[model samples]
Target: MYVCICNAVKEKDFRGAARRCSGGDAEQVYATMGKVPQCGQCLEDAEDILFEERQLCTRLPAANACQGLRGLAPA
Candidate 1:
């Protein structure tokens, strides 16, 4: 489940980061976790996984809210 093997970041780590990005900025998650992207290969998978997780969580708002500028607000 680790998203970035080089950095030792897990899928849950990415999930937590994505959740924190309620502000609609993945950079916030990256910064908070102090993770540096090594190879760019993980980026797409990380995002896709995060998206799927969010979709599965009914507690979260509709996915669209987290799509554009709307995601800048609270989740």
Candidate 2:
């Protein structure tokens, strides 16, 4: 589950970092987390995780998906 071999960062760590960088550039995430992208092999993996998180965040909230309650609350 290692995401950045150069920095010895784990996938979980990357996920957390991505969440924190939700409103900023991804490069800032790398810099703040001290993750150096050597050879760029892990770039795709990092981006994949970020993209997945972004997709999940954009989806309708679980409570909002319930029938007859779609507009009862804010997402």
Give the number of the best model, judged by lDDT: 2
| TM-scores for candidates 1 onward, in order | 0.60, 0.67
Tens-place lDDT per residue, model 2, 8-60, is 88888876776556343445557768766777788777777766655554564
> Which residue pairs show backbone clashes in model 1?
none
Mark the regions of model 1 whose C-alpha exceeds 4 Å error after superposition.
Answer: 25-28, 57-59, 62-75
The TM-score between candidate 2 and the true structure equals 0.67
Per-candidate count of clashing residue pairs (backbone under 3 Å): 0, 0
Model 1 per-residue lDDT tens digits across residues 1-75 = 878787888887777667555443344556668876787677777767665655554355565434332333332
Superposed model 2: Cα runs more than 4 Å off = 22-26, 60-75
Error of 2 at 39 (Å): 1.7
Worst lDDT run of 10 residues, candidate 1, spans 66-75
Spell out the clash pairs found in candidate 2.
Answer: none
